[model samples]
Target: MRYDVNLSILFTELPMLERPAAAARAGFDAVEMWWPFDGPTPADAELDRLAGAVTEAGVQLVGLNFDGGHMPSGDRGLLSSPATSRRFRDNIDVAVGFAERLGCRTLNALYGNRTDDTDPELALENLALAAKAAGGVGATVVVEALNSFENTRYPITSSAQAFQLLDQVPGTAFLADFYHLGRMGEDLSALIANHADRFGHVQIADVPGRGQPGTGELDYAAILRQLADSPYDGHVGLEYKPVGPSEESFSWLEAMP
Candidate 1:
């Protein structure tokens, strides 16, 4: 499995624009990120400058997320919210355009937290729109399961739940994030054994602590072997929070089977 650092989480020691270069210096030719802007539609110049930085750093931007509203405040995503539907729609072009500019072919749309009155249909509608927009650039829209313990209000807390929602949206794919799935008590070996052919992207952090592989109870060695033997061929993203300086967190990668 090819690996790419998740710049949003891994390289926070530097300014946002410098993270790509940091990844390159650390021997990574590819990187991915959560949305880096405060708002969905950043000015063209801001977008250009960021694109230029990634280009100059000589690393490929492999994946990106849509604008999830106010992430630090626990707002998971916007696509499903009736109040934010317009905002989510408006961001589709800008996000996909940025992905296109950098040759990134995968876009992830986190299903938002559900409220007492949330409509699942609305979420599906918005996701379909996202899938269609991404298709224009030959990119795919992937959905992942987030653990309910941390994401309290977020729906789709298991791979099963995520697939239930994704089932209705054709041509879309699954984002197998082992960190959240393991938190939900998913059997990593079983998941790869069964659904490896359907994965569009993969992210991993250890169970319990959400840190690098050895920081918690995850059996990454077995999981890596499963992925290696399966038909799934894609980037495995290191999406964990580092225990110390981000650069120090990757000793585990060298140990990958």
Candidate 2:
């Protein structure tokens, strides 16, 4: 099981432009990120600089998110929002282009919060459109489940909800984040056994506090062993919050198989 740092969370002490090198210095060869800018599209020069940073650091960018509107703040995603559908549509090409240039193949499309006026049909349609666009670039779209506690407005807060959306989008797959699922009290072991083949990528953080693996109760060794035996052949993204300095949080990496 290869491990990749999620630069969006780790090495956040540095400027976004300096993080890839910082991650490389910390001994990571691959990284993943959320959409790093506030808007759906950033200037071409900014994209070029970010791409250059990763390239210069000699790290592979394995995954990225589509503009999931102001993450950790308010909206979880724009794709499903009737008001922001146009922004979501406009972002697809630019996001796909960045992934292509960075050699990142997995793109996580977050399902937005469900409003009183939100139409489920429209959300499905938008997701399908996003998946089709990503497929054209030889990439796979991934839908992830966030915990309802933190993402109360986000509709797809469980694996079941995520699967339902994936059914509507033909070529997309699931991103099984253990921390979120575990927080929702899903049986992690059984989920892996039943849906391993459906997973495009996997992310991990210990539950309770969303800290690094050992800081909480998750049995990562057992989970990793299960993953190794399962059909999923992908990197496990370290998408946890650092308890101390980000560099010190990596002690758990030595324990991983």
Candidate 3:
């Protein structure tokens, strides 16, 4: 299976544009992002520059996360508060353009939550609308499931829930996050095997501190084995923060299988 490291977290010392090169030097085939927006909004020039950097690095932009507000105290993404839906949709277009420029085929659509004023059906409809738009640009949208205990604002917590919501959208698929799945007390192998075809991408983070795979309770071996056995074939996104130096943190992956 090809590896996809999140450039933002993996190489925190470098500029975002230079991250792909660092990932390439580490023997990774591709790179991803939690989110690449410079601010609450998207910028055309910045997106162009990022796309250029990816091409220059000789690595693929395997995944692009559309989950906005991923930064500290920043809020506004595909599924944020009701008032931000318009801005969110605009950002979706910008994200697709950026992905297209980078030759990326998959884009993550993280569902942001609003507990006070929004209805579930409305949010689902909005998600469907966004998915359809993403599909138009030849970029598949994968709905992300984050453990609520860790990512408090993430609306979908379980693989089952993610599948249910994604099912509402004709072409949208699932993203099984290992760290979140473990945190929610779900069976990682079972979830992956059951929804093999529906899964478009995956992410990793060890519990206890969200470190490398080998440092936590997660069975990276079993997870990789299950993926090998399943029909799914996609990039495994590394989304955890490095406990020490970035280059030293990836030693755990050598023992993944």
Q: What is the lDDT of residue 224 in candidate 3?
A: 89
Off by over 4 Å in 3: 74-76
Per-residue lDDT of model 3, residues 1-257, tens digit only: 77888987789899898888888888887988867775435666777778778888888888887746545663425464576566566676777777787778888876766457556766677677767777887878887777777567666788878877877788888887788888898987778777788888888888867888877887788888889779888888888888888878888777665
- Tens digit per residue, CA lDDT, model 1, 1-257: 78999999998989989999999998899999999998989999999989998999999999999999899999899877788877888899999999999999999998888876577888899999999999999999999999988999997899998888889998799999999999999998999999999899999999899999999999898899889899898999999999999988889887786
Q: After superposition, how far is residue 197 of candidate 1 from its true place, in Å?
A: 1.0
Q: What C-alpha lDDT, on a 0 to 100 scale, does residue 73 get in candidate 1?
A: 96
TM-score of each model, paired residue for residue: 0.98, 0.98, 0.93
Model 1 / residue 252 / CA error / Å: 0.8
Worst 10 residues of 2 by lDDT: 72-81
Question: How much lDDT does each candidate structure score?
Answer: 0.91, 0.90, 0.77
Number of clashes in every candidate structure? 0, 0, 0
Q: Candidate 2 vs candidate 3: which has greater TM-score? A: 2
After superposition, candidate 2 runs with Cα above 4 Å error? none
The superposed Cα distance between candidate 3 and the true structure at residue 24, in angstroms, equals: 1.2
> Pairs clashing in candidate 2?
none
Error of 2 at 46 (Å): 0.8
Candidate 2 structure quality by residue, lDDT tens digits, 39-154 = 88899988999999999999999999999887767888887768988888889999999999988999998878888768778778888888888898889999999998998888
